[model samples]
Target: MQLNWDSTEELRQAIHTYIDFYNNHRIKMGLKRQLWNIVL
Candidate 1:
């Protein structure tokens, strides 16, 4: 993926959003449909 951000805050926000999705919204088939934070 190619991303262009004007400032550090924008990059930080993008990373935070991706992490939130990965931890809270994404499903893990290998873990039997559970979120990452729940497993942690």
Candidate 2:
């Protein structure tokens, strides 16, 4: 997919926001394996 952003900072901020949401609120079956592996 193509991500269109106004500037580098915008893209950076968007990526940070996605990362925060994924880490904090997103639950995945793979997360159990990740936890065991300490991948996060």
Candidate 3:
């Protein structure tokens, strides 16, 4: 996949969004768990 960002902030935000989804919302089938589990 190829992506072009207009600015550094846009690229940072995109990475942050992906990390948030990976840690919180995305489920890892191999691990059978979220990458990061938060208890609050």
Candidate 4:
């Protein structure tokens, strides 16, 4: 895939947008959630 950006801001925005989508929207199968909260 070829990405065309007009400026530096556009490039940063594009990268951040992709990261947000990957972390929040996309689901990872077999990803375990840590449920224990222990204070040392």
Query: TM-scores, in order shown?
Result: 0.55, 0.53, 0.57, 0.54
TM-score winner between candidates 2 and 4: 4
Choose the strongest candidate by lDDT: 2
lDDT of 3 by residue, 1-40 (tens): 9899999999999999999888764445534444334331
Q: What is each predicted model's overall lDDT from 0 to 1?
A: 0.77, 0.82, 0.73, 0.69
> Candidate 4's residue-wise lDDT over 1-40, tens digit each?
9878899999999899999888875454213332222321
Off by over 4 Å in 1: 26-40
Is candidate 2 or 3 superior in TM-score?
A: 3
Encode model 2's per-residue lDDT on 1-40: one tens digit a residue.
Answer: 9868999999999999999888766566567768979965
Which stretches in model 2 have alpha-carbon errors above 4 Å? 26-40
Clash-forming residue pairs, model 3? none
TM-score of 3: 0.57
- Model 4 TM-score relative to the real fold: 0.54
TM-score of 2: 0.53
Candidate 2: C-alpha lDDT? 0.82
Of candidate 2, the 10-residue stretch with the lowest lDDT total is 24-33
TM-score, candidate number 1 = 0.55
Q: Evaluate residue 6 in candidate 3 and report its C-alpha lDDT on the 0 to 100 scale.
A: 100
